[model samples]
Target: MAIGDWSSRMRGAEPCRPGTEKNKGVAVSPSPARRPSFREVFAVPEFRTLWVSYVLSAVGDRLALVALTLLVYDRSRSPFLAAVTFASGLVPYLVGGMFLSGLADRLPRRSVMVGCDLLRLLLVGAMLIPAVPLAAMIGLLYAVTLLQPPFDAARSASVREALEGERYPLAMAIMGSTTRVVLVAGSAAGGLVVALFSARPALAADAATFAVSALLIRFGVPARKAAASGEDQPSPLGQLTEGIRLVFGDPALRTLVGLGWLAAFYEVPEGIAAPYAGRLGGGAVAVGLLIAASQLGAAISTPLFTKKIGPLTRLTWMGPMAILACAILAVTVLRPNLVASMGIFALSNSFAMYQLAANTAFVERIPNEKRGQAFGLATAGLIVGQGIAFALAGAAAEVVPPSTVVALSGGIGAVIAGGLAIRWRGMSPAVGRHTARHLGREASLTGQTPIHAARSN
Candidate 1:
């Protein structure tokens, strides 16, 4: 399918070719006897490699942040400079997502990912040079991260092709849960690796991981052509703008993206974790524990929710869960104790089911051909929104109490969640019923007892 044709599909035009189902917003149904096990998703060799590479790459990125922050602080003795270095990791997403994301769709997905890994490997390798100025090192870091969104876009788009029918949700849940778990583990491990050895060694390790990731992608993933095919292709900027237009123009897509953007506010507490912990008379350990608690909540809840709840039921719960999370977080403004705040933070993140549901819906509604750009746009919006919230909350905390800023962020998130819930409530019944029945059949199929025939009885 041509790239220009996606807008028509988004606008409810009939599927332009055979095998394209119109109104794919509804969940897919597979026969009970034919249902695939969630574990079977990993049995697909390509997806297994992708999942492993993602975890390794994500861990390396997290580790690099710790090493880089320490290296900058040690070299310059300037906390502000170190902070700027940290922000570079996030700020690039806005530019990269808007201008560079089209490259994910314009190039073969595997090539985009493999090329990104190789480029980052080279950049990080350069940072290891002792003679390189701190300014140049920082610049290299920024350039290294510019490739992140597009790589993520390509990886997510590939998942749609790797997993089919009921397996898609399972794959999404696994990926989401693994990410939360890895973030916590990676952060702590990164700090320890830097402390035990040194920044240079930690960075060298990260660079090597990128090389390994590149190799994994090259060997494991099948080569495929770009999504767009035509004599007169539009500019990259035009493609990105069209992607944005298509997302906002579709009701389900708009609501899903809105939920994702609202998460920016939800993430404000993490940005202010240190100050909030300080306000409670806690130290670095306290900050670590709080972050761990929040991640653990998401890691535990995502898989449980995916296993027990069907997609349709998950949709109904998304808005309410998001509101409850933020509302509970807002209550933390009452100056709760350390233990109490940690519990509340954990409870709030347990609602990761909201994102998982929205993501599944997004994958269902969007055309496979446009998945890269669509995922890119969604991820970029989340990063940009969250980056802004992080900056605003941090800045506001200078004048107001950190807890207050955190609470305000939550309150704002609640308001947004309420709006989404109201808009989405009416659309869930049919979709939810369809998804629930589909999942019910899969569960029964997986759980059914084997029989030797009535003759034995």
Candidate 2:
């Protein structure tokens, strides 16, 4: 949709009228606009540079993951170790996010990002050395992932700073779409490399990407606030707590985080089902197809997320919408086999668009200063939620079929998520005490519609 559409809908957006206690969740109006035309994402020199760096790094992430999995399998001939290689990397995601990501806002965005890239480069390079011990390879993987969340937070906060107002949702859409594309591209490229010359070439390629990504960050991003002034600051751990506190303090944010947590729970089967598929004799290529199918569906349905009315609204259909999405994903696990699992994943992804819209709505609802922590907390919630789901699914794989557990989890997630969405969809815009994100762009100060306002969120 056009900026004008979102502006009109958001401006005139009303709170839910109180009837039962049910309407308490979504009865607030969105505060005055954050900005007018956020569509000019690439217009920012720094963001464009980061975007390029991000795309390259995205490819590298996939390559590293694939190469590591293959390398571990080749060395040990143990499925459990290979699975550990894939799953254990995520442990740092939870820990780093919980204890470290708060440094994103507290530190210079540039230094945090550049430092992360270099750290990952060195770790990945370590993995590329053939003479390295098996434990050394695993250690390097853990280190690389441990550094992920802060870098992720820095990039997220910088995007909000770069694209104020109507452009924020568009930026999210672009980023989401880019992520899907990267997953597809990276996974495919990783598989091809593994098939051709084994995993070392892929690891080296990933390391190369990290090295260049670090260099580009130095060239493109501005220095940290403390570094620029030579001032000491609070620890990253302290900053992380502040971010968490900011997120929980706001009503709107709480709703967003809640739903995000549910979404994370709902998503684990998508990953776990791959190994399940492999166990059913679907093989590596089958596992790849399963991922590709779902993502393809997600890619096609991504545009629906730019909805102007937003999911966090009185007019929003987001609650049942989210429920339906989860129901679809869960039911995918009730299938007869892996092929059915893949098909269900593809179908479920289409239904999952509602969740994406809900996420964008949450972003739009949050104030400027808190956006860093809010988004960071939201990201953390997602990681935490997914971890729970993954762990549960993995455990379930030992007792019952993974597909069955996936379906059960999906069903439970849908019921809970649907109920939560229904309750929160009644919440008003709740924009009390909003913060200014930046200097206003001259383009839409009067709230005038753009000349080229062709509808395309």
Candidate 3:
């Protein structure tokens, strides 16, 4: 089949043919198309609204988590209870991603997102009630967190619907970079806010952010029909089963997801950051610096990778970059000091910019109707994998040096990445060919070289 036909089928849209445009059953001259700049992407009203809403919700969620964790510690004075409270936000994701993420495809995506925000608003607001017991507060927080997978799945699918071509990957880059910044800043701000006014006010602020997010999504985002709606749509369980098969059964997709899951290995440093810091004779400040350095490297590199590299090249380099991301961590075996360790972590994470390629390729391959469920399954696996990795790393650290654990993790990850890289290289030519064909068609319509074509040249 022609690449155009394949692309159209994947996106659930009609193929655009050369020398003509279809609009409301009328054929007209094709307009020129080019790669969108970040400014151009932001200029899209829907994208801008979604971006702002995502930022608000992310910051609010982080703030609430920190405040709740601190509150639990203050009252119970048990690090175990506090850790459980903190973990409450993550543990429910498996359930939600497996069962509820189908809602994004079954109902109107806008409705799903807005409804999730409103529900979270109510949940967070309840957390502020003085009569709510500490145990109940944690339950409410779990409920709030449970809504995240569906909301995130909907939002991700919606962003892809809103942006096409290079714009989608660019938007991903923007969001990824912003998330790092929000994580670092939100944690610090949450601590300060809790110190000054206590947890209730932070909870209230979280509720307010959710309210604002709902309003923005409702009023600012353009409504679109759900990708998988109608009486014939499968039940949630059916959808989940299909999603798993779709993601795991396909060799290419399986490899792509494996590449994405490389995080479980390289992120071990974060799981043992405190112990690693102590091993270096450093303090909490060092721990903070180590964590921040990891985020900083991704924040700085992701945008540059997306903006400077073309789509095909990004795909071509994804494997090597992922390998380097993990391989560099082997340097930890040398037991470097705090500054050197931070640099090692930063450089390792910088190579992780390859995730942009893996993510974009995965999105492009999946059918639009199944995108949400597929994304949810992928995310669920990632969260569960990271959870297990952290547990194992922590256990290993108890027996050996944290740096040794990190190096071991890196060495294992590098070996796995090497295998995945070999698999990906075997498959990449087909992807490159499809990309070239797609860009060639776009160039024919646009009367100029498409970005990927120019970059590949």
Candidate 4:
């Protein structure tokens, strides 16, 4: 399928009709028919291939990171260097997302993803060599990590192209929930693998996963031309500038991105889980539980939220849910016990499932040509924001109790979320108007009523 073909069929590509009811001026989608089932989503061969490949790569990546971090600590016995080794996986995202993600738009997405996987496979295999020094290993790891953003951008854009309408969000929910579960399981599995077979085996396993993932993409996914092509295609710098403008220039897109970034606030608990658990007279096990609790709520609730809720209703609840996701974190102020603290974290994350709505809306609004760069920009900002938030929370924890720091973060997030919520409400009418006009034009071209055009598309 052509990229432009999928772009034209994007959900909400058509606008509301003149007589449709609006919720406080926000354009709501018409009542959709029966929601798509997980079985139906999985029935798409491309989706199944992409999903399995994703799972393989994600698990391998986590296991490799854990094994590598442990190897560094065991060799050097320097806690700080070990920590830095672990963090190397994350710090490159800013650079890759900002500078390299446009490759997805410039090249066929399938090519970008497969190339990344093959490159990573080579890098991980290099790490398996006995003569590779610790410093050289770290450098190779950095090189491997740098390839992730383009791969991610390509994969995400491909998924959007593969699934349409409600299937897209449902696919996202599946991936989102799977990611949380994989994080927990992969870490545990990594530790076990290292304990038995050692780090070399773990690294070898990671290299094999990348090889398999590359093969899957090469064989299973249909090839499409780059989204941005032709003589008028923008330069890389031009694409970057356009992406920044496209994401921030629109009121709805900006607000949706803001809502998604609320993670920088609600996620403060994870940053301080160790100290918080210590305060509760708990140990490493407590820290693990605290961290897992944060992910558990989302894993359990997101699928249900997407499955049962209509798209319009999901949009309607997005702001309130974001507010609650943040506000609930303030419960830490009461200094709850370990189990209670876990509950608070879990409940907060359950509400954070609102992000599924924000994500769906953001993708629906972006043109396919700009989607990779736009997603990259959003992802980079999110990573930078969370990194800063974590650093600040850690700093504040030195002066005050972790609970107090968490409460302060939550309070600040709630205030910000409230302002953004109000802004979203004010901007709804404009979105509804714009959507209506677009649908009207499409209807004229199709010789159909606006409502009929909306449904048929």
Runs of candidate 1 exceeding 4 Å displacement? 1-25, 30-36, 430-457
- How well does candidate 3 score on lDDT at residue 117? 99
Tens digit of lDDT per residue, candidate 3, span 335-400?
999999999999998998998788877776677788788888888778878888998999999999
Please write out the lDDT profile of model 2 over residues 1-457, one tens digit for every residue: 1000001022333222223232233212234433333335678777777788888998988988988888889989998888888875467877777666656655677788888998888888777666898778887898888888778867776766665445655566666767777888897889789988889889988899888888888988765462213245456566566666655655555665676566655566665856677667887677777778777776676554553443233125556656765787667544556677767777776666655555555655544333444455566567656767787787887898777777787788788876677657446332212211111121144342222211221
List, residue by residue over 62-177, the lDDT tens digit for candidate 4.
89999999999999999888878878746797788877888998899999999999999999999998878999998899899889888888988899899987888788888888
Q: Residues 286-367, candidate 1, lDDT per residue (tens digit)?
A: 9998888887887788777876765556766888987876777897779888898888888888875678777776766766
Q: What TM-score against the true fold does each predicted structure earn?
A: 0.88, 0.78, 0.89, 0.90
What lDDT is reached at residue 50 by model 4?
A: 91
Instruction: List the global CA lDDT of all models.
Output: 0.75, 0.63, 0.80, 0.81
Residue 316 of candidate 2: its Cα lDDT?
A: 54
Clashes of 1: 1
**Top candidate (TM-score):** 4
* Count of clashing residue pairs in every prediction: 1, 13, 0, 1
Kindly give the stretch of ten consecutive residues in candidate 4 with the minimal lDDT sum.
1-10
Global CA lDDT computed for model 2? 0.63
Q: Could you tell me which residue pairs clash in candidate 4?
A: 15-435
